[model samples]
Target: MKDLLNRRRLWVGGKGGVGKTSIAAALAVLAARRGKRVLVASTDPAHSLGDVFASELDDTPRRLLPGLDAMEIDPEREVEAHLSRVTAQMRRYAAPAMMDELERQMRLSRQSPGTQEAALLERLSRLMVDDDLPYDLVLFDTAPTGHTLRLLSLPEAMAAWTDGLLAHSRKSERLGKVLAHLTPGSRRDLASPFEEEGGDANHDPRTRDIAETLLARRRLFHQARRRIQDPEHNGFLFVLTPERLPILETARAVSSLEDAAIPVAATLVNRVLPEEADGAFLASRRAQEQSYLSRIDETFAHLPRPRVPWLPTDIQGVDALERLASCLEQAGL
Candidate 1:
């Protein structure tokens, strides 16, 4: 497997109970220790980056260690901001009487499925495109497998949607011009009926603005898609335990990601039991783990499988993450 730490963008995803966030944090700390500036952001609604870093975090990046920073995206807050921006843009193009109805529809749309994911993607795009940050690496601690997959797949869908919108906008503009030229006194009022009074009916600036915005968004999504699919720049790390369900899910996720042209750089088989355990229960569990471990080795034979030992206690805070990082280093990850 390629060195995931060498990538500019890394997305860590796995099953819910798997130690995805812990591994992501560990990687960030490890990179920072090697004198690299790193920004780790959590896209999971149920955040644990703050817990792992043992520090408060918000939407904006906050410095945790010398060269490490962390941030937790609030989906609710992002959704609200997304709605506000959309509504504001709509108001500029919509007629006064339609404002109430548009606002109502916008509010309703907020409750619809995928709104949060869309908002999160918008924020993720901003982070990826923003060049002002001095960080050498940006690691995304994503939600569970399914949600993260959907989020990664969104750019293609969004690009198609934007293309349709642009096509419609251009068609409408051309039709408006034709009607203005055909009608006796309509040349001066070529503006759309949706436009506010005194707005140019024939060449409405609002329409151009909307088209420009869609074009900009399309370009942004295109850039994000290219960045993710570029193996030399970005990597996807799927974390799974030595168990049935997580293994299956990880396999499916890897297949789906490859189908989407996004590279799955490596897999982390976390929480393997030690061979020196003495108790019968531990022995039995270890036996089962070994069986699963063999299966994992056979299944992901082509990918790098870095096994992490199960710690004596729950992993939290910087110390535990450092220990995990050390283990990862020892495993040659």
Candidate 2:
């Protein structure tokens, strides 16, 4: 876990309601205290980073402490922005006759499945590939295990999708050239499907734009994917409690990430009962927790597993998060 701090990016994920946000916040604070400028962004739509920091947060980064910054991405806004950008670009190159239909399709596509995720991934890719980011480290407080896994897997999927689009565009360009040579008439007869009539069929700007856009998106996805899979540059931390369902789900999540070539840096077991706690109910719960703790050790023995004792009260505000950071430091994380 200590080595994980050396990485430039960290992604924290786990079962919902497992304090993943709190753990991510603690890590951000810890890194900031260590003199690293850290930006912790919440990718979960049901964001609680603002609640944890006791401050209002939005899409823009907000300073939470001297060197710590936080933000909660608004997925709906990202989707709208993404569609708007696409619409604007298409309007510039699309045939005038297609404008009404294109606008209608774009509006309808906003509610399509995976549209929100695609928009979110575009935002994430921009953040990861931005060379001028001010922060030294970026921590992602991700959604629950399944959603985060899908999010992390998106670059590859999108790259494949973009590759297909580029291939088809290139094929269309070749077909247009062949048609222009075979047919003797105005260039309008040989215009590619994407181009306006009477335009240069051999070098259609619209086809070039489509190909360029897809290729550029593919390049960005590749860049982000490389950075995410590089162990020296990125860390994936799984936060879970010592319980049956969370433990099982985390194991599966770790397996899925590893299969995607993304390394799981460490496992954090939160809300463990303290040994000093007394009472029949508490003692029994501790015994149950011990069993699950042993299972966690056995399941993830190859990775660092840091256990955080259950706090007497809910952790909120900077001070409590700082205390949790201290606990993490003491555990050598």
Candidate 3:
């Protein structure tokens, strides 16, 4: 278990409303208790880390407990930020009318399906790879199965996009230098955000270098794509309630993860009724749970299946979160 713990990037996912956030939070707290620096991030667009921690989290990472830090990545914010940086360079190159249309197009691009989520994952990979923010373990509270599957496969789309963008940038650099003479501002070439502003917006050395570097970052995305595809470094933890629909959805998600070559580390069955019973009401509930429990065992016979009992209340406060973590220990996950 220690060996598995040391070499895994655990990603908790499943159907929506199946307690993936709860399981991810518990696991994050458990790793922290074991004396590892852990970061629990929310990639779900709905953003529940704040609700789970009983505190607000912005784009910046915040310390949640003694050893655990948490953050909720708002996909829209990431996409807007990325577009703003890139468009500043684009404006320096294109004509006034063309720049206006491009800006409009970029805004529409944000509204495009999957763009925000993909950008969020790319940003998460960057944080994980940064030496300065090194962590012993990183837990991702992923979106529901459909969205999460798309996010996991985002690397392929991003790689393709990078290839096309790089080609466009090369052409833009040449055209931008030529167009600088046609503009009212007598500039040598369009400068990048990194370049100092001269009378000619095109003449900024920082802008030119930024354009070159942005194109080069294609290599970084490629490296991230390769890393995400590796099983040893990435683990998918499927969370579900012991119910029919959730169970079926989990099966579909597991199949998709396998298709994408992402590893399934374990299965977490949450809000399970305890096996013990006293009266008719309690006994019938346990019996129903037992039926589904049997199905889960049969379904995931090859993998470790950990069960977490239903708490009397929502696992919101730190004490409740810790109690949930204790259940993980009891199940020997």
Best-performing candidate as measured by lDDT: 2
Residues 1-333 of candidate 2 have per-residue lDDT tens digits of 577788888999999999999999999999999999999999999999999999999999998899889999999999999888889989997799999999999989989988988889888988988869998999999999999888888887898888887778777677766676668674754556445545453366777777777888888888988888899888899999999999999999999889889989999999988878999999888888889999999999999998888888788999999999998898788
Residue 78 error, candidate 1, Å: 1.9
Shift in Å, residue 19, candidate 2: 0.4
**Local distance difference test, each candidate:** 0.87, 0.89, 0.77
lDDT of residue 62 for candidate 3: 92
Across 1-333, the per-residue lDDT of candidate 3 in tens digits comes to 333355447788888888889888888888889998988888888999789879889777799898889998888888988888778877765788797789889989988977787678768778646656668888888888898777767667767776686567556755665566567876543533322334343344644565465555555666665666677777778989999998899988888877877678888899887655378998888888889999999988877887888877888967888998888888786
Cα-based TM-score, every candidate: 0.91, 0.92, 0.82
* Stretches > 4 Å off in candidate 3: 1-4, 164-218
How good is model 3 by TM-score?
A: 0.82
lDDT digits (tens) for residues 1-333 of candidate 1: 326788899999999999999999999999898889999999999998898878889988898889999999999999999889889888876899999999899889889988898888988988887778798999999999999989988888888988898778778776776676678876454546534445453356777788788888888888888888999988899999999999999999998998988998999999988666679898889888889999899888888998888888788888988999898888787
Error of 2 at 222 (Å): 0.6
Estimate the TM-score for candidate 1: 0.91
